[model samples]
Target: MSEVQVVRGEMQPWTDRTSPRPALAALLTDVVPANRRTLILGPHAPQLIESVLAHSADVTILVRSVADAQQLGEDFGPCLQVIAGALDGLQTPPYDVVIASDGLDRVLGYDSADLSWSERLAAVAALAAPDAVVVLGLENEFSLLNLLDSRPAAERHGDDEWRPLHDDPSRPVSVEQLRTALPWTAEVYADFASRTYVRADVAANARPGEFPTRLAVAALEQTDVPLLSPAHEGVDTAARAGLLGSIPTGWLAVIGAQPSHDIYTETADTVLTADQNLTGWDTTISGEPVPATELSFDPGVVPATVSAGVSVESVLFRLASAEDVPGFRKLAADLGDWVTESRVVLRWDDVVYDGESFAHGVSGWVTEEPVEKEDLLAAAWVRFHERLVGQHRRHPWPPWMLGDDLVSAWLGMSGVEAPEQTPATSPDTPPATSEQVARGKEIARALDEVLGTATGTVDVRTALAEAEAAKHELFELKGHVYGLERTLGFRNKAMKTRENRIRELRGQLQKVTAAHERIRGSRTYAVSRVIFHAAQVRKPKVVARKISRKIDRKIRKR
Candidate 1:
């Protein structure tokens, strides 16, 4: 093996308070497996360091600051090998994994005068063994959220170093560019709100209006919702509603000799869109496909049993009543035929259920062609509407009053079409009659009344500003309360000390008073007093007479 090159620089010491963003931490922990030799580039996030230390062995970190090296050295002791210097000449052995989570662009890209992004990445890659994996977190320059919000929303830049070169922010390096730069097969994962990563495979299956910008709209409007979890805001709802298909917020690139473990795990039953586009059952998860089993309920208008070798549309199984079978099947077939004739190109993959033996039933069909976003949903709705109408005719109820399931399925499929940008109107419109004109006027008046009652005005920008000010005030009050609490604690301790001292002095005073009383009652003190009075003898007789009287009185009393 050749000696490794070490690059040293007089870099500024690490000073900014930094911790791992949850998404970055998740990316690192997912890519770098346990008990493997790992090298962390830059000391941006301490949490990432701690995670590597806990999960891997013989951890080596390449940092640029002496202060950072000393701090990290003291933190991990002999367990970590902290190297403080430039990246151009680092002499180290190739390891199993190399992680450049935060400030990758700065650490090796522009922060170093000697290296470009390509050179920086190469230097880091040199430390990785042939089979070693490299994981990097990068900013998406054309991030949809940033574009939509007209602000910097992506977690791409760090405070450790300023870029030496200025580049167009609008023209970020494409995924293809990244793939070409790094050695080995590179897989990029787009980070969703910096919480979870959405794979590009799943993203390729997206439909219109469900792209990253539109999905982020819900999250941005409801700003209080946290970005760390996809469940917050409307991300989970949007994912279930089929919005994120083609783009993601940011990227985490994994490069190595071959394909490594996926950062995310998806199940077979997962739904990626509202129109049954990209269901989990359609793709093999973790390299294994879920097997099809016999559905128990009678498939009303569909197949009774799906054969193992033959492929069909995605299936949703449920138990249904026997009475509703014939009508449901007839409607489904009519819809399937109509949809096929209309160029929607779908096959009714059949609903199969065994009412006599089993309880489970299945609904949904396979499509013969790629799902077109426009027509498939309308065809499904027409079929559902016809089925609902037929059921209503028999039950003496309205179409909307049919079985809840039938109504819901119809509504869900009906909503797939994006609303028109402009109201439909014809240039050669027919003139209205007097009666029609009067009715229109009355309707307009009613609408105006409704609008007047329903609407209230708000200055959105002003409200947001006020809310922010209130938040800052709340934090200030919290600081003041914390200080008051500390002062109270100190005063209480002082009061306790003073009380203890007072108790000690009281005990000493009590001891001194007892001693004074003992001394005054002694026989020596009484005899000395008598002798002194006798020596003063001008009135010795009188003094003697007084003493004798007192002695006689004491003897009588005894």
Candidate 2:
């Protein structure tokens, strides 16, 4: 078995926070079966682990960090076994479900000298029962976005040891590569931001119905720009040009045979997960199962009732025919534009239909975030106005039908008071009196003159004073800046002068020390020193006579 680190006590409280990177929690819930023996290869995410535990499934997590394993063990009690080791060391009875949320190539130590990537994949396959499902997550190195970003923003900082693990030759497998690696053919899904996954073919087709990430949509709205970066523009262009599969950010490959799971039927209302309502049939419409995206509100075509003061994430509108699909898309787009303009957000999931106009067929609009009913009502009014105005231009509706009462009712739903205005008459209607026409023309000329000039121009004197004050402030700031520079220059010169003086003193001191060393080492000095020492040893008078005789000899020679 590989090295093990065991953690077996209480851990710090697990406070939930939003994950900055895309999370696979929602996708895991959809794919993994309930009440089964499941094994997770990595426990990097506590929320994902907790979400799996919520399904009443027996789960085992294999983690590299003992502390993380210990925390998982502590937070989840005996039900969850947090093993601290590599995948190679894991030994257990065959599991019904195995999930490698942290890419398969990474867990295997692809570049390690001990094990090859293929061997690691085989080792993981051995852990799965014959009928068990295995899910593997992988990054797309060739993702079109990857081309735009050679080095990710996250990795620009120095610590990048993890990059090699992901970029190893064994990883970021293509669909064909995945087929070759796994024993059984798998269903490969390409994902956006690791959250939005679609069938490989569907993604590659780049249909108009494709939904973008909420963050992406929100960013576009903020900039009031479409496709700001090359990466952003690449995705849209690729999807439109049927090249999404060729360049996906990540892949979720489900290996082994897919098992049948029971559908949930407890609630009449169907809630969507990860921007998708996975339940094929709506329980609210009928107990019977219908293969449609929306519930069949048949037998009656009354407008769907949305309760006030309640926050909703999505609303379904049944379309009359497939011919209306394009028109419905237009309406959805218009609604999204209006919502964004209001600084609110609403995203389109897709437009789906099943033949019967009033029954199984429906078109859905999803909000990026849950919004109040009033906001939804305002969005609906915008949609209505677009539709009405468009039709009114080509084939006009009678004034009464498009009158104040109708507009007012729509506005009242959103707590807005509709502005009062005279109903517009048909263009073919009779002309007005000559006197009335003359008065209208005069009013038009006067209004044009007022608008032609700048109506809100400031007083010239006030503007001049403000500009003059700004100039004075600029000059004062420059003066202070100049004074600071002068002071710095003086200090620099003084420092240089002190350094030069120190250098000169050091030169003079070195010369004096050299001369003293030369005098002490001379042969004559050594002889004289010896004679004086000998004289001193004999008598103090003899030492004085020897020093005087040496000085006289030296003076005579000079």
Q: Judging by TM-score against the true structure, name the best candidate.
A: 2
How far residue 181's Cα lies from its native spot in candidate 1, in Å, is 2.3
- Please count the clashing residue pairs in each candidate, in the order shown: 26, 0
Top model number, lDDT? 2
What lDDT, from 0 to 1, does candidate 1 have? Answer: 0.48
Q: Which pairs clash (backbone N, Cα, C closer than 3 Å) in model 2? A: none
Q: Which stretches of candidate 2 lie above 4 Å from their native place? A: 1-23, 54-57, 105-116, 150-164, 209-230, 257-558
Candidate 1 on 1-558: residue-level lDDT in tens?
112223565255454356435445544655677788988877567766876788898788877676667777777778788776767647688989888755355454224455556656677778889988887766655444444442243433445455443353322355665566667787776555554455555444433223232223322333222222222123324344554422345667777622232323211222111112231122112222222231111112222332221111111111022344445444434333334222222222222122212111122222333444334534333333332342222332343544333434433333322232453368664322222223223322332222131122222333455578799999999999999999999999999999999999999999999997887799987888778866778986887799899999999999
Compute the lDDT of residue 191 as modeled in candidate 1.
57
Model 2: lDDT of residue 39: 88
How do all models score by TM-score?
Answer: 0.41, 0.45
Q: Model 2: what TM-score?
A: 0.45
